[model samples]
Target: MTSLFRPDVEALAGYTPGEQPQESGWVKLNTNENPYPPSPQVVAAIKQALEGRLNVYPDPLGRKFCQAAADVYGVDPDWILPANGSDENLTILVRAFADKNDLIAYPYPSYVLYETLAEIQGTRRARLQLNGDWSWDLQRNRPLIEQAKLLFLPNPNSPSGNSWSLDCIQKLVPPNGVLVHDEAYGDFAANPHRMELLRSEVGSQVVVTKTLSKSYSLAGLRFGFCIAQPDMIRGMRKVKDSYNCDMIALAAAEAALLDQDWMLANRNKILNTRAQLASELSESGFDVVPSDANFVWATHPVLKHQTIYEELKARKVLIRFMQFPGGIEPCDRYPDGKLDGLRITVGTDEEIQSLLKTLRVVIEDSPST
Candidate 1:
């Protein structure tokens, strides 16, 4: 029988999201979701939206959400493009800018979705490897940067939980290509590279994408937006789904934006927890990467990565063990080594304490390095 799918789709592997275990009583910290609940304003606004509008389609352009984002970010509403989520924004970007023959460039071991999107579009990709220290080196990556039509750079990049400096970013700005500064975890970092230079006369080539998932504690809400020049926003809007954002999401996001103080309070707590987790893991003989995101990426000196991951899972404390063969470079691989890298999301203080206690026991039970 002949396959009906595109050849690229047939051969490509889909993105694997973090496991969401159904069973209760498990310490779920594998996914980078905020442990705290969303603001009261969000809940109230959602309830209000439910009471009035279920039959009508939401504003196709998400005017209110764009306005709210504009006010918060100090941009004109025409510069904001709201989406179902940041993931949708990624899709829109791929469709809006790149053709099947164009090259899409992104850092390897960053976001897996960028590669998947390119594959779906049947576009070629230039997977640039990070330096041994997991930082971007512009001189080394100039070839890929020059060839790319669309470039995705994630600040406080995922899996590694480290960031590229603004100076590093400036060197990679393409002379005639689109640069997407994916800032999904920017709020957690102290000095996130916002690419505010794009807002200046030299910024027409860049777009900064953000989400309500992490800092705002609204992962389930599925709301995100991008900031760019009005021309870029208009181009993306033309390629987006007719009614990308629903009424409930719009109301909830607007309310959440209005109550940024509540979100900031929760952000501070998560930052504090992240600091403590990193410190504790470092003291426990793990080579913990200093993270600017809400999670800590660490590798143990002795234990095999899979062994520790299984032990934690069996003990009902779930954390992410990254083992992407050709995607993310394993931090713990030796001549004959087990895949070794852990990305642990920072939870509430009580949950962090529980995780620390369980981790200590797991390490103690294992053989010494």
Candidate 2:
């Protein structure tokens, strides 16, 4: 049979999102979604939006959402570009900046979507491996920086939940390439690398993305935005869909951004729970990576990650077990290129307690080393 898809798309493996099971009574902690519900303002705004605007097309530029983001982030509205989600923003970025056969670079074991996006665009990819401690090494990745036209960096990077310093990231900005700081998990971190500072210094060369999904408890709403120079924002807007974010999402995102206090309160609660969970897991012979995200990346001493994941699932508790080769290697663990680990999302107090109890039982039943 003749294939209609592009050759690159035909050959490329697609991104696998975290599983969303339909069954009730399962302690779902695989995806790093916030356990809390959206802010009251968000709910109200969404309800208000739906009351009369179902028939009208959404504001194509998402001005209200952009202004809300600007007010919160201390940037101008012209610097913001709202999208259906950060994923769509990333796609627009790839399409706007790099062409087929152009070079695109990202740290290995970071967001898998970056690589997948580059593949779909038929762009050359430079997958730079992190050091033994899962830290970026600009000196080692000098060649990749030199060759690439765009770089995607995730702060408090996924799977490992470890972050790189702003100084380190500044050192890695390619001279002739755009640097995209994917700060989806920035709100949970102690010291988020300030995009405003980077933008002031480097102008359009630096682009930072933020998603309402993780922080604002609006994953289902699917809204995200990017901050960059006006020129960059203008270029990306041209590539984006005419109605990227629908009316409900725009209203919800604006309300969520306005209710920053609610988001911060939930963030503090999650951070506290994260600390307790990490401590408990470590005491139970699991090497839990220090996290700045809403999830913990951990590995057990005596069991393969797959075993632990399956065992937990069998008990009606779900967590992520990923085995992307060269994806994550914390503290020289998995030195033999075995990047297998479990990413457990932080849930509510009762939910987390339930997860801990199940985890203890699973660990106790495993065979001794």
Candidate 3:
């Protein structure tokens, strides 16, 4: 029997999320989840929402959370559009701008979801390959950018943890495209907010999407939002579901934004642990990327990353082992056909110590010389 689904949908290998192990005692660091719990305020707010409303429909606009985000980010409530997750914002961006076969470009080896989203929409993708240092080759990719209708770039990119400079970001904005700045790890970076770009004359063409999953310690809640000019926000609002974010999520988001101190406390702890993790990897004969996010991207000098990952997992430690098989544009510094590395999430101090201890064992015990 013939399938009713679209051909691309039928053929697509949907995005594979980070592994979630159900068993206990595993130091789960594959996913970039905040090590600390959310604020007491967030807990209290959820409890209140549970006692108040579960039957009625949630606010389609999520105005309360919008207003809180606006206050925190110095943007107007109308300029913010809340969603179930920042991933939804990406879907909406593709739906709003790109048509089937329309050009959607993004930095290669960044977030693979952008490609998955484009595939779902049957849009063309021009991978803006990073020079081996993880910097954009604006001159080389200019033509691709010129043709792109939507561009999704993750700041402090996943699996790399390298943040592109603001000047670089400005230069990569497609002249006739909507640049979706996917800042999922922005809260952990030194320079997080890019809202000033929205105030500039060229603001209309830029859309910044954020997720509470990382910094706000709300990964389980599935809440996030996008920031753009009011007009652009209105257009996106029309494209989104009537109530994409539920009542509990809205309550949590609002509370999380208002409790900045708690988030900062966690952010600081993660940053400290991240530094220690990177240094430990470096001292253990691994080349570590200078990370601006809550994780570190590194490669072992002697052992294959896959081997290291497997050994670590065997000892009840889980981390992401990633590979870009092909379709990634290479650079002179790394004139390779493919790239692979490890992305280890920043966990608690004890977790880091366990990771380092186990990593040492993996390295010392390796049969490879």
Candidate 4:
């Protein structure tokens, strides 16, 4: 077959998402989706929206949804830019800000999508390796940050499941580039909001990306929004699709925001489950990261991570496993070594218990244990 794709596309190994199991009996924990269902009000709103609105083209600007989001976040409507999901917002951000040869800085092993975005845009990526403790290395990134056009950073980072404080973020600000903060898991974290950081002295360069996917349990609906200066928001809107968000998604997301208590209740459940999961993993000789999100990153000190990952898969329990430090395939052998455990999502009570049982048998049987 004659290949027509660009050299960059030909060489790139694209992002791999969490496994979706066809087997019904398996306990899945790979992706960090909300375990519980969305609010009844959200369901009702979506259904109601489906009645007569399907025929008409939705609002290109998505003003109604923007207003709802702004109301909840306490930001002006002009500052809220709604997208199909946070991923869409991020892609647009890179396209709008970064040029072909321009660079973007981000923490390595943070969000896999950031790398994908950088590559697709043909922009250089300055990946700052996280310290042994999984914290950002600001010193290493200082030089790259100065020249980069955009920086994609995830707060309470995925896979690692740890958060950087507002003070920490303040100190990491790049002198000239735009800082796009991915707060997909911020709802579950202890912080009230990162919007305040943008209001500070360095307000111009920061944009906070949020999603209804995690806390509101609206992953299927694909609703997310970003908060930035009005000018930045305008730039994003200009680049986004005219009808990026559908009527049902807009209506449902609005309902979800309105029922704040419902979202809080679901978040509390996950937080409790995350605590229990982390505590159990720690006691069982796994070094579990202190998670502020809906999942925990647990690594067994002695066991090879690949071995544990394979054991879990063989047991029909799915979880996320990354090849550490610039590696592409999840199964690629780690010559330099990577974390040797799993990124387990905090599922419901019964599901978590099932995982613990299998984990106990697997860990105790390992030579390290």
Q: Could you give candidate 3's per-residue lDDT for residues 1-369 as a string of tens digits?
A: 899999999998755656887778899889898878999999999999999869999999999999999999998999999998888888999999999768999887788888988988998887888777787778899999888889888997887898987777777778898888889999899987588767766688999999999999888899889999999999998899998999999998999999999999999999999999999888887889899999998976457888888999999999999888753455543456468889999999999999998988888878663
Please give me the total number of clashing residue pairs in predicted model 4. Answer: 1
lDDT of 1 by residue, 323-346 (tens): 756543334333333334888999
Tell me the alpha-carbon RMSD of every candidate.
2.2, 1.6, 1.6, 3.3
Best-to-worst order by lDDT is 3, 2, 1, 4
Looking at model 3, residue 305 earns an lDDT score of: 82
lDDT of 3 at 5: 90
Per-model C-alpha lDDT, please? 0.85, 0.87, 0.87, 0.82
lDDT of 3 at 252: 89
- Candidate 4 regions off by >4 Å? 14-17, 327-337, 367-369
Pick by TM-score: 1 or 2, better one: 2
Compare candidates 3 and 4 on lDDT and give the better one.
Answer: 3
lDDT of 2 at 183: 92
lDDT of 4 at 327: 35
User: Where does candidate 1 clash, by residue pair?
Assistant: 198-203
- Model 1 CA lDDT for position 39: 96
Task: Order candidates by TM-score, high to low.
Answer: 3, 2, 1, 4
Models 1 onward score TM values of: 0.95, 0.96, 0.96, 0.93
In candidate 3, list every pair of residues with a backbone clash: none
